[model samples]
Target: MLEIRGLHAWYGDSHVLHGLAMDIPRGRVVSLLGRNGAGKSATMRTIMGLLGKATGEINCNGVNLLKLRPDQIARKGIALCPEDRGIFPSLTVTENLFLPPVVAAGGMDIASIYALFPNIRERGASRGTQLSGGEQQMLAIARILRTGARLLLLDEPTEGLAPVIVQQIARVIREIKELGYTVLLVEQKAHFVESLADIHYLIENGTIVDRLESAEFAASRDRVERLLAV
Candidate 1:
């Protein structure tokens, strides 16, 4: 549902993304995969309009995302769950989770969220600062799902968490996809992305240098792995 071409992004004088290109069709999971210094996070930030300057085209469905403000971008059914932050620190989990009122027509209700991720409900009383990283990540996903956004730009959802929590996050991602949500994921974990991604883009230095379908990736992970070996 999103299309990007020749994308260029900058952080003031520092040019981070160079002619990056990506295409995300509806109801599928796509990933941007690379080493730590690659521009995966920068690409996501540019799409969400969080950066001060970026160029080229970012179209969600038929709308040109470049023309819209950040809040307007969200209202148009896109959500960015960043690597470092996702929730309002001052609010309780319950408040941060449901504060954004439903905008479009397909959001999950409170009961539905509790159903999909009971972890969130169990920690409802905890402040955003009090929840663990995994809980905050889940809360971030829940908050976006509550907004009726069909496309999720999830950046490193499994980073820094324990393996069990990573598995839990994976399960949640699969469930969300099953429920008809599309995802644009940024991650360094090749195996993790391999499990859930339909297509994968290998980014380097500021642009996508290669791409692999899941089968190709599975059969040839070693090649990609070596490229990311640092």
Candidate 2:
């Protein structure tokens, strides 16, 4: 569903991605794993057209996303839940979720999103700032869901959540996969990826260093740990 080839991105004069290439198959969850500053988030930003300068081919479902604006890329069925969750602190949960529906094709109904995230449903009236980290994460995902986007670019969705909430998020990811959505997951949590992802791509210094199937990834624990350790 998503193809990135020879991708390079820079923030001002600082180069962050260098010839990174990877493909995410339709309806599969592909995890991008790396330690801090290894360009995982940079790749995500470039894919979402958030970077100021980028060079490469980013094709999503047959369209070239590199030539499009961020909103245009999003309109092509990609929704990003950024590393920081990007919740609007002033808006209530429902409002924050409904805000992105204006730009999307098939708008997601509140009930379905509420069903996917019961916690957010329970705190439907709470402002973004009033939520816990996990709640904020849920809000972020739910907000993306409301956009009716089929491909999700999730950057560190489990970053600061409690273990229980992380598990819940993992389950939700699995559910989304079952529902036929493609997910490009950037995460530091290897264990969670072990159970959720179909394939793994290890990136370092802005390039893809290794690509492994889930079974191969499971068997290379030591290598995975070495690459991810700071």
Candidate 3:
């Protein structure tokens, strides 16, 4: 549902992404696999208009987002859950979640979000800082879901998360996929994405260098290992 082509991004005088191109098909989860500094997160940030200057085409469900601002990109049904997990530390869990205006139809109600994250439901009155890392991550994802965003940009969702919490996040991702949301996932944990993604794109330098569909992964496991090692 999202298409990117010839995309480049800059932060002041520093250029990060260069002519990166990729596509996220509808109702499917695609993982961006790469080592650190491979521009996986930069791709996500550029797609979400988080960078100061972005050029080229970023069309979401046919709407061009490269020319849009960060908030404008969000209103077009795209949401980014950054690695840092942005949350309002001063606000209560419930308050932080409902703060962003729902820009589209089908935003999840409180019951629905709470159902996916039971821990969050229980700590509805607690301040954001009072939650654990996992809980904070849940809150971040849930907040975006409430915006009724059709596309989700999840950057390193399992980074530094405990094994059990990673499993929980993986399960929730599967559930989210089944609900028809499109996801572009960035992850270094190959095993975590094994059963979840339909396609895996290997990035290097600043662009997609290779890709393996689900059927090709088992046969090409060694090549993928070598590619990531580069």
The residue pairs in collision within model 2 are: none
lDDT of each: 0.88, 0.89, 0.87
Top model number, TM-score? 2
What TM-score would candidate 1 get against the native?
A: 0.95
Candidate 1 colliding pairs: 1-25
Clash count, predicted structure 3: 0
TM-score of every candidate relative to the true structure: 0.95, 0.96, 0.94
Ranking by lDDT: 2, 1, 3
CA deviation > 4 Å runs, candidate 2: none
Give the per-residue lDDT of model 3 (tens digit) for 146-212.
9989899998999888999999999899999998999999988778887899998888888888878
Of candidate 2, the 10-residue stretch with the lowest lDDT total is 100-109
lDDT of 2 by residue, 1-230 (tens): 88899999999999999999999999999999999999998998888899999998987767878899998987788888998888899999878877776466765677777788888878989998999999999888888888878889999999878899998999899998998888999987788899899999999999999999998987887898999998
The parts of candidate 3 lying over 4 Å away from their true place are none
Better of 2 and 3 by lDDT: 2
